[model samples]
Target: MRRTPHCRRAHQEHLGKGTPLSVIICDIDHFKQVNDRHGHLSGDRVIQEVAGLIARQLRAGDPAIRWGGEEFLVVVQASSGVAMGLAERLRSAVEHFHDPEVGQVTLSLGVAEILSGESIEQLLGRADGALYRAKRSGRNCTISAAGN
Candidate 1:
């Protein structure tokens, strides 16, 4: 939640300097079932591992926040292409994770770049809508905002 404001401020500042700002909303694929079948401890382990993987992949100064249960928000100061690439890397890392407890974990990501006159809420909403699309498309994939 706090990260949202920081992301907005960063986006606002970078927008003035002609730098693009992108946000990624990542959700664990079928996370509720993981918890139900493997227990909450296993779910916690998966969450920790996922968070670590995301943090490791981020560039210096980029923010990766645990947005909610099985969901994360990553804010990057880069073009939409760069941000999408970063998300793909994270998704691949999660896919190939060799977890002894939860086995293979996967992520669905939504990437959205800040438009010239977009608000933070609007930006997040777009990314979230993209996330819904990714989930509906069978998960473990990445989808950028419309026309992006």
Candidate 2:
């Protein structure tokens, strides 16, 4: 893909009009342990399953990218509250998803609404930081960039 997404400019236009767009950063909790305890094959399956779950649940046209090994980033044309609600759904889905080989895998997510005049990088960083908070607070939960 390109350095930035084409929809980002669209997001900027909405931001220009004072509309909020939210980003959600998701990571598989204790992914390394999964790989160590099971195997790379199982770990890969876990990532693939989680990624598919997230991708399938988001808005049809929204961008759901594999941000890293076990991480996914989603950008949606919605408010922080809306995105947070979506994240919780994804977290719950992952929680209840039972992989025969990988067992149960949980997701921790961070959500951030684009601030006025904020760049895409800044928005994503804030979202990622919020995800880190969720990871720290334990796992299998969602956290918003605002306040906490």
Q: In terms of TM-score, which candidate is strongest?
A: 1
Model 1 scores worst on lDDT over the 10 consecutive residues at: 1-10
Which portions of model 2 show Cα errors greater than 4 Å?
1-3, 15-19
Clashes of 2: 0
> Which stretches of candidate 1 lie above 4 Å from their native place?
1-3
Our model 1 lands, by Cα RMSD against the true structure, at 1.5
Q: 30-96, model 2: which lDDT tens digit per residue?
A: 9999999999989988888998888778877577788878988887778888888899999998999
What TM-score does candidate 1 get on C-alpha atoms?
A: 0.94
Question: Per-residue error at 2 for model 1, in Å?
Answer: 7.2
Winning candidate number (lDDT): 1
Estimate the TM-score for candidate 2.
0.90
